[model samples]
Target: MTKILLETLKGNPSDRVPFWFMRQAGRYLPEYREIRQNAPSFMDFCYNPDQATEVTLQPIRRYGMDGAILFADILVVPDGLGQKVWFEAGHGPKLTPVNTEETYAELSLNGFHDKVGNVYETVSRLSKELPEEVTLIGFAGAPWTVATYVIEGAGSKDHAAVRQMGYGNPELFGKILDLLVDATSEYLCAQIDAGANVVQIFDSWSAAIPEPYFHKWIIEPTREIVARVRAKHNETPIIGFPRLSGAMLETYVLETKVDGVSLDTGVPLDWARDSVQRHVCVQGNMDPHLVVSGGDAMVNEATRILDTLKGGSHIFNLGHGFVPQTPPENVALLSETIKNFRR
Candidate 1:
């Protein structure tokens, strides 16, 4: 087979640009909605291998993406560690904060796998069901990214709470990062064993931190995870998506040792081609909002991304996941454009 994603990650030319998006298997699709109905709750669906596998495969079946990512949230790591994590209808995820060394010490890694076992089951199912040509991707939010939710208790536009906590009490913060490095590495390795062909670490909040803190919290912890995972699962490619870390993108890719780096919407293409492609496979940089407003505008922007990055290792994808308001037809058109592109 086709295995275009894997080939492209290795810097080989593919028959077409291998494509998949961040949150590709999320709320944008109707099948995902139907599957979500069967899930007891958001966490229930994630912890249920069968439902998780169904959601994971939903977008792949509908769009024929080059990759199929597991449908589980990043906060599952915190939940597994004895922190109380929940999702309110409109408010994204929330976790009971672990602010002190004593509290962090109280959390245990024992039975962590058992708690999140369905994730491995979902990976196993996808391995057997997916066509040999399509790559199966498994992922988790990186340590620093997960920490933001754990400390702040939910999504925030500024991430001020976590940053201040990191600045005020780095010792405790460092301990949490350490625990995450160990936990996330083991979690991803388990996914590889369960048959995930690739693993991507989502450092969604990396850009929010200042330079020094960014290196200490975001870059360092991520590098440790990459090195640990690569020690055992060397062949399993890792993609690092440090969302919004514009100027620091090249440095993050070089220092973190990830096999691929995913760019957010605002990252300039020329910078990506010259700086990033030299270090690792690059995926993304298209605005998801444009997909919501599809037509010639979306088509032109998509073509421009492809034309600029055509000669290098690239994966066609939206800068982020599609929004709930996105029309199903828009997704179909975007998929068709990528699959049918001549280059």
Candidate 2:
């Protein structure tokens, strides 16, 4: 059976738009919370293929989404590189900072595959277990975004330190990005080998990048990874989500040569249709908050998104991940709305 998500990613005409959220298999679902409780730590949870597989399929079981993104975290790359990565109870991910050239040199790709072997196993199992029609997506943090965590140690409000490093220490920062490019290419290829039909590079911090460095930091590293992945798996589709890229979206799509581009909520609908969808498949731009509100408000916003992008290849999705407070019923309603929408 032809998977609609894969077909859409290939820019092929489909009977209807395929839909899936960024963090679809996550905290909002009670079932996921139950499974999460079983594991001692978040990293432990991710390392368990059985539990990971179960969580990955939970959202699909509930919503019948067209795609099932692998249940994994982007920090796995830094962890695989031998960084000390941990998650605190209320706080998110915490890492031992790699702020200098010496620390940067400490990151090695020697045991990368061994460190993340479980994730590949999860992909291998998911490929066999998922419904034939559901596209299995594998993803990793884009180098620049991942580097920020490595350099700054955790999420930051302004990304001041990393931005300053990018400007003042271009050479060192370039080395860090190069290391990620090599490691990330290997990691993504392993996912494809494990049967991922599509892969997405998530540059969640692209919005924080200064305009002058967009190409150097955002475009170049991504282009390198895409080129390397395509060299080996020419047929597997790649999606680039440079969130909050604004007018630079056109440049990103053209230079990186991604098969699809995921738009954040800030991207204007008409601009996306004319500037982006005209070039490649477009996924997203719906405000995730609407799902939290639900009812006619949710329906109206979703309807508008569907109506706006109806003219081209599109995937129904939130501008970002679903938050923990999002009502499960709202997800069901959104799914129903998309399944029922017609051009």
Candidate 3:
């Protein structure tokens, strides 16, 4: 039998629903925080195979999740592309913004693998260590999302700055997108070589653009990356997480050709079962906040999604990462609630 997570992605129903969470390995768990102290910086922790590998395995040991996603930041590509990338304890990722060709010239693909080698080591370790039943998902931020940080230097409220640069100077913006496409494709292909069973591309910022801009920046670039990855690794499943691409989700699934599409909390279950799942396996749509609330709302939402998508191929997962303030027991309760549900 196929591992539940992969089998579901292959258009087969599982004996029980397979479960995993976005940002499954991160600040929410104390063990992850405890281990973070042992490394010099966030990037150090991500680059240190031992430390990264430990954090990657922490959730699997605690929650017995159906899949263990690698522990590494999506901004690692920026660091690989020769931009200085870092995290401020309270602030989030910062990078050297590439606004011009002169600035873009500073980024070199030379030794890109050497720069992010620890990520590969983390994948290699998890593959050998994870239980056979639990699949290991490897991932990277999509070009548009990662490029937002590279162009804006940090997270933004409206992403107005980058979108302006994209609109104002299409050529320069196109160059950066092209670089990211080449670099991200190489990076993900390398992760597969290192031992990632499934690779997910996180296009978290796709929803911000209007339809025309969406096709140019989000859909086309993602389609290219997926096609490139498939050329070399046909067996590995690629799940696309276009965080808030609600109405256009079906278009992305068909055009990008990803093996699965991760639904955010805003997507309706009935719409997903009738539309998105007919094309590719669907994963996620649970409200992480509801899981945090952990009462009747949590159980009801979980049951509704499962019931709606029952006969179709689906995986149970949170709409986004488990937040740091979430009570651990809530996660446990939600996990159990999902396991107990059946058609």
Candidate 4:
């Protein structure tokens, strides 16, 4: 059976809007937390095919979401390129800072597949293991977002370290972005070859960029990655999630030529339906916190999202992702609400 999400991405809406949430298989799900405890580190868990595949399937098994995103980190691209990466217990991902052209030069694509081949193995397993109707989504970080972590050596509130590098020395910054573009292209293509049905590039830090250089830093690398991936897998749908890019999203959609665009919470649904959905399939914009505090209010807002985007190609999903504090029952409720939504 052709997956509902895939069909939706092709601009064909079905009886019920195909639904999935970002970070669906995450800490909010107890099953995931149980599995996570057994693994020593986040990256280690991602590199382990068996564990990764199981976690990827967990949300699908529980909520019957139409999509199953690969369970891996965006930083995997850098880690594959030989940068030192580790996850702290509470703080999140940490990488050895790559601040210099020298450090960037040291990172090579040589033996990259050999290092993170297990992620592909996980994708390979998921392709065969997922329900026939479910779409298997493979993904990576966009160059700018991944570069932020590479320069900062961890998640940042302001990305000051990255700005210092980008502004003080754009030549060096360009090199980092270029390298990321090449590496990310290769990484995502490998995932598709390994049996992924689609891919999503997560530009989580895109909003950090100023408007003047948006095209230089955001659109250019993404367009290249989209082109690179399409060159290899012409039919594979690519979804670009430049979270919180606001009005620039229309520009991103047009220039990047992605098959779909995942809207962040801040994007107005009416604007997205008019500007974005007309161009490509749109997959989100619901505030995830609503689901966490599930009730009549959550269902009402979800209904509003449904009613708003009903006219064009739409996939029901959270604006971002579910938080760890979210109740699993709430997730189930939200899933059922999406499943039940109809025109």
| Candidate 4 lDDT by residue in tens digits, 1-343 | 8798999898777888999999999998888989999998888899999999999999898989999999999999999999999998789899999997778888999999999899999999999999999999999999999999999999998888888888889999999999899999999999999999999999998885787788998999999999999999999999999998877999999999999999899899888988888999998878989888899989999999999999888888888988889999988888899999897
lDDT of 2 by residue, 155-255 (tens): 88788889988888989888888999999999999999999999999999898566779999999999999999999999999999999888899999999
Residues 127-191 of candidate 3: C-alpha lDDT, one tens digit per residue: 89888888888999999998899899999988888899899999988989888999999999999
Q: In candidate 2, which residue ranges exceed 4 Å CA deviation?
A: none
User: Which residue pairs in candidate 2 collide?
Assistant: none
Candidate 3 residue pairs in clash (backbone atoms < 3 Å): none
Candidate 4, residue 132: the lDDT equals 99
User: In candidate 4, where is summed lDDT lowest over 10 consecutive residues?
Assistant: 205-214
TM-score of each: 0.97, 0.98, 0.97, 0.98
Task: Using lDDT, give the best candidate's number.
Answer: 2
Per-residue lDDT tens digits of candidate 1, residues 196-226?
A: 9999999887875779888999899999999
Q: Provide the global lDDT of candidate 3 against the true structure.
A: 0.87
